[model samples]
Each structure stands twice: as structure tokens, then as C-alpha cells.
Target: MHKNAFAIHGDIVWSKNPKELQTVEGGYLIVVDGISKGVYPQIPAEYQGITVVDRTGMLVIPGMSDIHVHAPQYGFRGLGMDLELLDWLNTHTFPEESKYANPEYAWRAYQIFSDDLLHSATTRAVVFGTMHVDATMTLMGKLETTGLKTMVGKVNMDRNSPDYLCEKDAATALEDTKKWLDEVEDSHFENTKPILTPRFTPTCSDELMEGLGKLRAERDLPLQSHLSENLSEIDWVKGLCPWSTCYGQTYEHFGQLAGDQPVIMAHCNWCPDNEVEILKENNVFVAHCPQSNAQLSSGIAPIRHYMDLGMNVGIGTDVAGGATLSMFRAMADAVAVSKLRWRLVDQNLAALSTEEAFYLATVGGGKVFGKVGSFDEGYEVDALVLDDSQIKTPLELTLAERLERYVYLAEEGGRIVEKYVAGRRVL
Candidate 1:
């Protein structure tokens, strides 16, 4: 009766080794319904009764993940590209975030982010919502419908932000986050879940961080926030916590780092040696937003070095700060920025190749949810079906090469024809 079995016939790429890419050609990935059983060169005789979905001639890879992103900033992407990190956040981002006070206004904004997510090659993500509880709830409800596996947060920021955007006190901020959790506790999305979001150390008080930390232990949920993304931000973090050794250490001291929490911190552009050790030691996932860093004039992150050091790193759109939703663009930008960084400052062959960059955008980030990011055996089948029909009619290329072209050559909307999250059709 084959209760749970399907045959996925395609060129399957997945990881048996975490670092080295494994590609199986002319293969049929025999999935036990949702979970992959094994990939064979041909459909085996015993599993012939299973439903066979022919993805032959299509490049089947794991659905990409955006581990760090700000959903509220979708409306303002590419607007303030000329500004640096702090200025961009203050002049454009903070004001846009404050607009979410109206849940109606929030839905109008979040719909754009949601629609874009399904449209792109990414199928799983960790998203950030603004502090407005009702608005954040509306955003969550909307994102849940997309069928993407996501962790969303109601952001907490008590001080150093504008009066319109900032909270009056830590207690109120903590209460608001709890209220958010309570409301969404019964929300029915297979993938959408809530996590604690303190905007950053500069805006969060000691009390707020501690309370959230306590809640983290209680719920055993994943955590997401900004880390040493910029020089000014790192210095601001230092000013906030004089006792701490580095930016990441402050979070560690607050018990936010190095646990089973599945913590995701965006941007490691300026992570010092001590900070790197802390992040690596505690098993922190770095949401490497290369384009946002360059657009905001934040220094290029040492991505190759981080990979060499065996740090858990992945790509993020970061939306308005990043100036794009397309992780494909992020992939290209990561490569471009690394080259610039290597030429201008650090010298060496430290640039990220297209292969490496796309790998991070997909598999590296997917590990946060589980064994996602690839289409081998016994893995969740989150996938983005790319259509290069209009873009590449004449070019004869390899599957991986076509994938690279899909990232650089095609515009945002056309390439990702359909999206699948955990073997369920989303597009």
C-alpha cells in the first residue's frame, strides 16, 4: 500500500559531507513520502508502486534559507543605499518600522515580504517583525500562510531609538514580547513559530535581555539578533556593556549564546578574535548579510576566514538594509564584496566563489531547521523550481553553471517558478 513513498527523478545535489558538495546524476531520489529514503541511479524494483514526480532535466537542490532578515523593512528596500549602517537605520529604517503601529499598515507591508519570499528561491527563513504586537501578529499570520518554515520575532527595543519606535521601559518591552508569544501560541502554521527578539544591545536594557533569556530557557526556542555587523555598532555595544570583552560576549554573559537555543546573529563584518571564539564556542549561527554590509558602507565580513575557522554562517537578505529580497542577489553580492575586501584591505585568495556563496545561502542556513538545503536521502524536500526559459534560451551549460546564471542573469521574479517546503507544494 506504500503509505509514504514517492520517486523524485532528477539530478540531485546534497551533502553527505557538510563541506563538500555531493551531486548524483541521472538519479531517482526515493522519498518515503516526506523524508528521503535513498537516491538511486534508477527507480528500484521494490519501490515501483510509489508516485513518481519527474523532475528530470531540472536541477534539484535544497531550498535556500535566510537566517536573518527584517520583514517590516520590505517597503523601503533600495531607498537609502547611499547611507551607512547607523544613518540608514535612523533616517530610513526606524521611521519605516514605526509605521507598523497600525496592523492594517503592517499587513500591507508584510504581504510584500511574504509574496517575495515564495517568489524567490528561498523556502525557509528567520524573520524579524517590528515591536507593535498586533501588527507583528498580523505579520505572523500572513507569513504562516506562505507554507515556508519560519521563525518570527516581535522585536524589543527599550532605549536609544526614536520616541515613536522605542519602548518606554524594559518591563513593558518584555511584557509585549510575552503577550506576542501568548497570542501566537495557538496559531496554526506547521512552520511559523515565535522567538524572542531584542533589537540589539544598544537599544535593549540589562533587565530586558535577562527576562528574555529566562523566557528562552522556559520555551527552548531559537533566538535571533544583530551582532558585530558594523564598527560603530560594535563600539556602541562596548559603551553599553563596559564589563564585556567583545560584542558577542555580552550576549553570552546574558546566557543568550552557546546553548541549544539555535541562536542566529546577523553580520560578522567586525568580529574580533575574542568575539569569533565566543560565537564559535557557543555554536552561534552568523547571518552573513554581505550586500547590506556593502550598501550601508559596513566593512566586508571575512567570510572565507569564518568558513575556514568553521563558524556556522549563512546568508540573509536583511531587506531594506540589504536593498533586496532575492537571495540570488545576496549570493552575487557576497562574491563581489569579498573580492573588493581582498583587494582593498586583506590580501589573499579569500573571495567566495559562486559555488560557495550559493551553498551558504541554501544548505548552511537550512541546517538551522534541520537537514534541509539539499535533496539527497532522508532530508526535508524544501525546493525552489527555477525557470530560465526567457533568460537563457541559447546557452548550453552544466546544471550548477545554470544555477549560477540563474542567480546573476535572471531578474528577481521569473527564475523561481515554484517553491516547495518540506515536500508540500507552496507555489
Candidate 2:
């Protein structure tokens, strides 16, 4: 028998494309040595006797991926919703992140975050850590034990931040970042990797961005940061980069937009046509964070417009800016906010359907990690077995309908009865 091979029998669902969802009820999803062999109506003859973990009457789907989230801000998820982006960062986020400098506090906070993530439906995440190198490393160590593929970034901010939380200068910030990257390189972490993070244009000086861009290219590391999240933030960026045409141009000028590695920019709520073109030209990943947008009054992102333009897109919980770490809630919020945008802001742009939301939560977000978040052949096997018996319904519903209900109604860390990452059961 193949050591890591197994078969799961249940209602298998996955996105064949953004507009199509493939569903196979009463089927077998085969995993051979951590790679999916595709879903079959019956066990193939070659693997007839392989171990079949029966999950009949339940939902078997690809595990979700959170392409953007802040690990240090998880402790204050529901606070500061009343404030806008800039004020909230000063009032709640900065003060909270400053606490991460203490190794013990960081370990405790990251432990809670990691434990919740392990039980949740996410198997992959792109996370943001604070500027403190030791504490960021601690966050990485805690998440490494979850068996989930994660890209953790140590944030760089040399200006426009609280004195307690800000780095001394561009050189100091780059040196500390290099030290963090070196630690990540020397660590024995199997599932955790480092990404370059510049907090944003207002906080990251030109010199710091230039240095980070150079480090990103030299290390061939992926990058993540915020962009055009709020109107005030966009205005601030325009003032900071007076020579740049748009907020996205600030990053583009620094060679931080795209290259050999992926770049994920969160909350492009106010990116204009030119900025959108820049993002598309570079094939940048846009992480649409609806709940965060709503909480901070940051305005709704034109997710449907981005999808229509064939832009790379994904969903993120965004932690403290949002209220919860549940990607399901994020997906639902995406669908809800799109409706409002279509009705009130732009009639030409249509609302996102639950199906499209699911696509963003799965295949779209998985694109960041490459060939992930699908049950297609040759893809890595990351599955979530959900027990929906408690979500009682009197009438029969299609598997898709059941999944839609779960997206909106299922409780995080509770309904996911079994979790698998690369065909290995971690929960």
C-alpha cells in the first residue's frame, strides 16, 4: 500500500473554474502519496483495496485558504470596529501589536490563533506578523505545529507609526527583517515560509520600500501588504508618493508589484482603473476583505469587477480589522457587500453569488500557494470533512445548497469534524 494513500467516500465538491462547481455525490476522492488522483464514482480497480475512510452523508470539500490575515492582531478581533482604518490602527492595532514584543505574550497569543486555525476549515494561510523579529519567529513556531501551509511575514514600518511600534530607520528595519528571514531559513519548519511585508506606503518610507524590494528579489520571497484600503489612506499615499500616479504605483515604482514570486495586496477597495490595470498587468493577487472593509468603514471592494476583468483574487478574514477568523463568514460577507455595492454604488457591476464566493474562498485563494484548494488530479490533497447533521433541515437540498448553508451558518472550529493537509489527517 502507498504509505500516505487513502480514499474518502462522501459528497465531493470543488471548483472546476470560477463559474463552475464540480460536485460528485456518493463518490470517492482518492489521495495517492499526498497528491489527489481525482474523484471517482467508485474505487478504481488499481486501488480497490486501499483504505476508504467512509464519510457518507457528509460534505467533503477542499480546505479553505486565507490569503491575508494578521497573526498579532488576533487577540483584538472584535474591537475598534467603530474607528476608521488610520484611527483604529493607532487606537487599537498599534497598541496591541506592541505587546507582541514580549516573547511570552506572543507565544500565548499565537498558540490561541494556531489552535483555532487547526480546528477551523483553513489548511493554508498568508499571515502578517509584527515588526518584532523574535516575536514574529515565535508566531511562526506556533503555527508550524498546526501542519498547515503558511506564509508568515515580519512587517516593516519605519515611519508614520507609533514610536513604540515603529522601527528606528530604514536600515534598522531592513537589517531586522534580514535577521528574521535568516532565522526562518535556518529553522526546521516544514510548512511555514517567510514573506516580505511592508506595512503600507504611509508607514513604509521610500528607502524602506526600496530595501524591501531588493531583499524580496534577492531572497526570491513572496510579498504581502495593504493597498487602497480606505479613501483617506489612498489620499495619504498620494501625498507620500507625489510623483506616483496612483496608490498601486508606489509599490510598482519599487519593483514590489510582481516578479518571480507572488505579491498579495489586501483591500483594494478604492483602486482606480489605472491602478486596476497595473495590478492586472503584474498579475498581483487582490485579497478582498469585506468584513474588515465594513468594520472600518473602508468601503466595499469591487470584487465582481475584478473577477470580470480576470484579476487574481481571494478572500481574507483580516483578523482585528474584521471580526472573526472564519473564512466562511468572509465568503458570506463578500456576497452580501457585493449586493450593496451593485445596488447603491455601481449598477453595471453585479453582485457576487455564493458560488463565486466559494470559488474565492477555495480555488482563488489557493492560487497563491500554487495548484492548491482543489480536488483535481495532481493537486495536493487538503480536505475538510464537515458534519452538517446539526444544521438540521426538514426538506432535501442539493449538495451545493447544503454547502451554501454551511458557508453562512456553520460555526468555525465546530462543524469541521476532520481536517486533512496534504492527505495527512491533522485533526
Worst 10 residues of 2 by lDDT: 408-417
Per-residue lDDT tens digits for candidate 2, residues 44-136, read: 888888999999989999999999999889898888788999999989999999999898999899999999888877899999999999999
Instruction: Find the candidate with the highest TM-score and give its number.
Output: 2
Alpha-carbon RMSD, each predicted model: 1.9, 1.2
Collision pairs in model 1: 36-378, 62-373, 258-282
Best by lDDT: 2
Stretches of candidate 1 off by over 4 Å are 15-20, 393-395, 412-414
Give the C-alpha lDDT of model 2. Answer: 0.92
List model 1 lDDT by residue over 114-210, tens digit each: 8888777779889999999998888788888888889999998998999999998989988888888889886755679987888889989898888
Question: Model 2: runs farther than 4 Å from truth?
Answer: 1-3, 412-414
lDDT of 1 at 422: 84
